[model samples]
Target: MADMPDRTGPVDPPGPLARLLHEALTRLPADRASAGLLLAVSGGPDSLALLLAAAELRAAGRLAQVHVATVDHALRPESAAEAIEVACISNALGLSHTVLKWRRDGPLAGNLPAEARAARYALLAREARRVGAGALLTAHHLDDQTETHLLAKARGAAGAAGAALAAMRPWRDLEPGLVLVRPFLSVRKAALVEAVRGQGIAAVDDPSNRDLRFARARLRAELSCQPDQAQLLQALDDAQAQRACEDAALAERIERLTRVGHLSISPLGEFELGRSEPVDVSILSRAVTAVGGGAYPSPRGALESLVHRVRNESDGTATLGGAQVTWSKTSLHLRREYGRNGPPDLVWPAGASQACFDARFDVEAGAEPIARLVPYGRWGRGPLGHRTLPIGVNEAGAIVAAHPALRWKQGETPPALAVCSRVGWRLCADLAIEARSVLTGRPQNAANRGEPVGKGVADTYIRGQVEAACVARREVARAHFQDG
Candidate 1:
């Protein structure tokens, strides 16, 4: 990759990224409440190019609004230093910026790569909310998409073309608050690298990227060396287009098969004589999720398996989805899987009546909203107490769910019961601990509730407590449900 030919243009770097970005944003999501966008800039080739291009667009009046963000994983001793450098570069470029620091030592996400990605979006979304941004953009180029497609293919993803990963997604699945715009998906890695070089810039290389044990680094290297890789990339584009068609058809079918107020029906003997089409199982699952007022949250394999199970399910039963899923004669029930005890009943601190689960929702006491917040997503109320919700398609900036909402918060701590109050005060009281827990998933005892832990401990304590709450919420997890 270091030896790849340099192809850079000051105006438009030659590749699909430019095309994708220009094409995708022609019409951003139709949110009247959308705030300025937040761009993810790593000082790396991909993101640096993104920042530069975005600034240029804004200057030329192409992009009306946007900002910049660089996340410091801080995995290495020098990570912070590198981030500071990135901040310096961004400032020189006259872009608004912020650095999200990540801890090296933490309870490992099942896959380190997956965890890191999650942490990045979580951090990015968090910052976006703070700045009143509606969406968080990324610099994932065509090459990244190609690699993603291949990886998905390697994992046997059938419905969608495996390597068409660079497709512009409306939002991140985990963080639906922000739209994840990947304008450079069409551009090659060589192009971005060259763009950075042409600018006389140096990009940071994470040591983890060099470790071949990871699939991404390996695929990247392999694709870079393959003959006629250009043609292969073209094929992926075509496949992605095909998948788009199938997904559209499936979306329509699923919409028809499903209706609000009715549980999903498992039609048996429906496939016996081919009298009726199976309706792509993948689409069916996604449709079912939509009925719940939720987007797809199942992992690739889990979702695939669930689709299969539901389609081929007999009179018997099965289970699947984000939490606990049970298949019965009645319907396929998808819910969150909890730790020890199941859901604890409603117990908002002493002040509240019925509680609101999703941060996107608001609770009004009198003429004004008692609770007006969206963590990593968006937050800001109008003068009339009307909210111009800064909404994107996925989860991005999320602060924290109310702790009293946590079944565990009901015990005896003095300040632990402050669930439905102001967001700023509760967050300051627990951020250090939460940031720590973001790295390491350590357990925090409830006996010492309301007390903050060391810098690196919040990831665990908060996550555990939150996870408990998520599951408990599942007992009553009605997706997209809101109160008047």
Candidate 2:
């Protein structure tokens, strides 16, 4: 906590900027909106403006609850002090604020900005969960979106050009329960600065914004002199619309495959794809991320090469992003790669009832304390039924817990302990979100004036599809476990 400033009532008016905030907040479900919101205030002009506008909305009775969090990356000498400044400002507005510090282990290697960004999100997400907030809001404005679009083109990923052009989504699932929303993507940075200044608040300016060493900073410098900002924005809007259609097409195919049993995702994070038609490379890339436990999909070139081999009917195994793909005569299997770079053996700490391992499986502990959870390969892969599923063993190396599908009758797991695959949940949840996005015709650029066609019908159809997929998933899970 920090000292509060002298102020009262609403920090600012519910003007156009505040209306933008209200519109973004409305995108969330009523239940989640009621749950509260965690704002990622970095003390910069954009975030500071966001904080002020949200405070106004809260005072105006338009917002239920709002919380503020700042990430102290500790990258610069003044980072800690800047976080305190944010806290002081938040307190003046009569809002709760938190400062999350990024703990580094040893030296950081490879892509410092990207690593810092990831760490910031992880810390913010943990804090959001602790505070019972369902949505994490960031102050990414139109200028930021433009910069992202330019950077995507600079990356030269031609194979994924369509996706790259889409830039960033307006709203996306950060994790299972938490949703990340950027309400200012349609707003301009200058308007935010003016709003903050109107409140008589001085925002913390980081020199890194103009540091030419970073590509974004350099792009920003160049764009300041460019005359065609609107043109770039229009390009981004066009690309986003195209990408939305492409995603809808992909979701449609995925639904068809799951409905017909040509594609099934086991609760143990294994993907079984029966060879009937040519498999989409995008689907394989998605599977690689889901089963391999990678934070993102594999690179397009790698995925394209793998897809080529699979299409040519190669009868062998290929590894990408710590996932192993085996092609058989009639089907293809994707599982976590064993030897190296795979999930390490983990112990279920005493007193903790639940845990997540390898970013894939969610585990629940029973009353009986287990020794360690190791890959099935270490405990004689044959008996547990599936080669990909992990098992918990006692001190004597006897299987005490395993996924319901992989349990062996010889040493059946107790009723209390359970292992559920996040991969299954993640895939189904993603499909539902995509289906809704496509059906509702939600554009990435929220400021677009285009009207959504058949929104009600689209919503109903997508909801039904989602329910059907879940039902089909349950049936497949039951059959797979029983057969195993």
Looking at model 1, residue 392 earns an lDDT score of 15
lDDT of 2 at 206: 94
lDDT of each: 0.45, 0.68
What's model 2's overall lDDT?
Answer: 0.68
User: Candidate 2, which segments miss by more than 4 Å at Cα?
Assistant: 1-13, 28-34, 274-276, 308-318, 327-331, 344-355, 363-419, 428-484
Ten contiguous residues with the weakest lDDT in model 2 = 446-455
lDDT of 2 by residue, 1-484 (tens): 3343444555455666566666555544322233467899999989998887777777776666678999999989999999999988888788899999887867999988899999899788777766667778899976788889889888874355665676766666666556687767766677678767766777888998899988999999998787566577667776766665666677777777776778877655788899898868878888888788787778888999998899896588889987889997789998887754237777664444555677777677765567877776665545322655666778887777665665455655444347656665445433443333222223222211222211222333432232223223323333332212
What TM-score does each of the candidates earn? 0.57, 0.77
lDDT of 1 at 178: 39
Q: For residues 331-405, could you state the per-residue lDDT of candidate 1 as single tens digits? A: 554332222332222222123322332322222223222232322112332221112111111123222232323
Best by lDDT: 2
lDDT comparing candidate 1 with the true structure: 0.45
